[model samples]
Target: MPMIRLPSVLLLLTLGCAPAASPPTAASPPTAAPVQAPSAAADGLDAEQQAWVDSTLASLTLRQKAGQVVFGWTGGEYVAADSPEMDRLLEMVERDGIGGLVISMGLPHSYAAKLNALQRRAPVPLLVTTDMENGPGMRLAGGYALPSLLPLGGGTSFPPVMALGAIGSDSLAYQVGRVIGREARAVGVHLTFGPVLDVNSNPLNPIINVRSFGENAGEVARLASAMSRGIRSAGLLSAGKHFPGHGDTEADTHIGFAAIRADRARLDSVELVPFRAAVRAGMDGMMVAHISMTGLEGPEAAPASLSPAITRDLLRRDLGFGGLVFTDAMNMGAVIRRYGQREPLLLAMEAGADVLLQPIDPREAVDAVVAAVQAGRVTPERLDGSVRRILAAKARAGLHRRRTTELDSVEAVVGARPHGELAQAVAERSITLVRDEAGQVPLAPGRRVLSITYAQPSDIMAGRAFDRELAAGGWTVASARVDDRTPADEYARLRALADSADVVVASAYVMPREHSGTVGARGGFPALVQSLATAGRPVVAVSFGSPYLVEAFPAVPAYLLAWGGAEVSQRAAARALAGEAAIGGRLPVSLPPRHPLGTGLTRPVRTAPGHP
Candidate 1:
């Protein structure tokens, strides 16, 4: 395979030799909010690409510019036949020329078809993107998904992305990206908001968790660069996340604001390291997280999204990132809670966000920006500048090239037999058995096996038929679901079932690292574990989300972390359970008490001393 082509500025970024950001020149009256550069000046692509972006930007009207900045989630129960919210959003595209849309969690399959229809209704073609980080099901249920990245973080042979970088196989990073890219294209997703280049140095960072590659800056940078290339080559755009860094924050932006407390100097060497690599490796866009920074703004000020100094002066001018800059979901509590249903969307634009992701109401958000422009708070020129960037981004995404797909071809493309096979293979490679103290994988023919689901049993069942796989491997499995709130009688029932079985494999699904809104894990995992812990027989804890599953419950001896709740991951777990494959994955994040992020023992099966 060909090597990844680095951006021209890679050397400066890698060496930390980037030129400093000049103080904003307030002398020139701010236009729109603040116009940085026209699409023409922004294009680093040779003359032809620059000309294309310029022509595209010039042709778009002010309404189109305003439309390009916002994307819709389209929640709320709507007309059964057609989505009322989506239809109105489409009007903004067809009548007002919106640029793109992001599909969020909790929409029915019919809703997706309606979305496809809305895209077709657009007069100026619109781009559709989704946060299919793991798989299409991440956004839409009953769709394809990979196990979370956490499982891949644990296991045996190869080092994590960090290890891969030390060897400089930018190719490995690219191959990983290729897998992501191919999977995205296969699912009709055009953009991926991942490869979280945050350099996960802090263990307590609730959100970044195993979503990041590792704690090493160079490794995170290399893999992110590789992954970005893979995504692009797959004919999609990959966005490096939290533009500056959200890794160190103890809090998650999904819930509220988090301050990094990093000065410019500290940011340069550590926090900003991965972002610099992403830009240099040609990331198509950067999503600015809702976290607050130290030197970037005042203590009482709003997030980086509302600070021109952070987004414009730092990201655009100093770092020389010229692609699309989006803010993390406008619906996030950080923006929505204080801004209280509105206003902050406009403030984000003033802060230099080219795309407003997951806005509560794109129509109203656009109108507010329009109102701001009219009121002279946001200059028309700055508005045009941001739209120019958005348009340029869409064009690069091949919005310029339209393809025809019949309804028959749609199922063939995404739901094809080959795609399923590939998904199965990836899933098999990802399953990890972190600690097999008893060495129980290769079960004897008569051994009884028990399978207990701690959380998200339904999701774990969909990817591949795990029970069937276990059955084929010559083990009898008795399966049960458990939760934190099970009554004593119910715990007794599941425990009795496990105790009766010769071996038990308890699978736990994890939450998304958000606050423990309630006291227990979803689907009563804590309760289930407590119940299972009562049984002294050999027990295995398989975590499908957090690699830290072993730490969460120290009572279990055979510990396994699948790292995600994707079908492939479960399948991989099933195959590993059957002793059909060798464990090659290791913990990507530290699991605390048991082992650090890089701990896993991969010894081969042993025979008695005189057996041979």
Candidate 2:
């Protein structure tokens, strides 16, 4: 845990009020009429826009200025604009003057309509943001459900950035970014909290598993930089998120504080690599994680979101990032558990955050910041600096001229046929053959296949698409689902089905999800698969989620990494299993000493004679 050291120039730039080294030279004679000094707003903004920003800032009360830094969430599902939720949100926009909205859950058209209505009521246009990590479909159901990042890299599967790292193609990463931006902007999303810069160095990390690009610093940096550029190219802002890096932590910050134990030197070399690359790539914004750096922040292990040393000094000054700085979410357990609700919001702004995202109580948080300002604990100049950055970002997004989305064009742009085709192609290419020790894959065309889908008991239909794809391939496929609560008798029935089948294809849907806290299979599912493999049934394990499943159940004779749980990923995996397509994906992250990084076994496309 070493301290971060900033370069002299960056330190001076970030100090905000460093004295000039020398007065204007005699060579540049001062005009007697008036020495009109350069205005602070003129640094990044044009005169007209800066004047407007200054006027707007002048017009706002301390409370309103505080509210401008607070961002609230909207699901965009309400059909009635007069609903209680809508009314509450309108109050936040019109009365509280909340500056931004993050689209948490919603339908495309309804979300657009709601945003338009909110915009009409607000004094200033809201800077709208969304997760949109995988694509607009990640949050907006009707939008193009781009394949999760791991599966998107190859051709169209929206191979996860990990796969893109494995493929080592910056161009492919750029394309993925472009698609993300295009679809996101179509739905009125201004910024995407994406291109997760965390280098998944720790295999046990629960939150950032496959969501991150990969373990190698240089590779992650290369791909993330390309993706950020693609997002910018699409006229939408891109955020390189969970910054400082959440890759090495084992805990999920959503539930509690996640600690990164790396020393400053280690962080500089590994964790901070992609972030530095992101800054160089001109990433528009960065979302600070609620992670603690033990070495940097001391034993209290303060979350980076509330740490000026981490956010302002390390990220802003040392790293030289001049764009917007965002907190991951003030509502997250890591923030609330330590600082309570209101204090974290004020602390985040003091730590150099321009946008206070997803506070537990938006109004209360704004009130606390305003009170802090009134009490002289927080300075108005500090508040104005963040407000200026937020406003500048909005202007950059063209929100000043047009804040609402075109509802009629959303459907045409989202989930467009060509994008679907591209997705399918990428998924097909990303189908990786991890192991084929027994040569069990490409099951003989007419063979009897038993497909077992393993998921939580709540997700009964999780593998329906995988089953459908196998059926469509003309295999005599029988599907069985096993969860944690399945009885011993159910296992007996499943074993009988596996015994009858010529080949057993098991789809392990142990994806990294919110609150799940683990990526490994649950409910003795892996044990059952192990039993089938022990019984001499040719078991081919296909992972629709974590690629590291092989490390958990190494006894499985054959293995495949589908990289995602998307329908396209399932179908592509099914096609690969049925010998209808090629299996060419390589492992993006290492499975430690057993299977190092870059470890996929390649196989040529196999189709029955005259089938192609």
List model 2 lDDT by residue over 1-612, tens digit each: 001122222110000001112211111112111111111221356666677677777888888889889998777453487789888899889988999988765566767788888998899999888876655555555222222212211111254555565556566567667666666677677888888999999878887887887898988888888877777776778778888999888888878878988889999999999999888767778999999988776778789988899999999999999888889877778888888888888788778888889887888878888898999988999999888878877776777667777777666666665666655666677777877888776776777888888876544346777889888878888888887788889888888877778898888876666666777886767888887777677999988777878776678889888877767777888888777877777778887666777888876676463243
Model number with the top TM-score: 2
Q: What is the C-alpha RMSD of each candidate to the true structure, in Å?
A: 11.7, 12.0
TM-score of each: 0.79, 0.89
Off by over 4 Å in 2: 1-51, 142-159, 607-612
- C-alpha RMSD in Å of predicted model 1 compared with the true structure: 11.7
The TM-score measured for candidate 2 stands at 0.89
- Best by the lDDT measure: 2
Q: How far out, in Å, is residue 275 in model 2? A: 0.2
Worst 10 residues of 1 by lDDT: 10-19
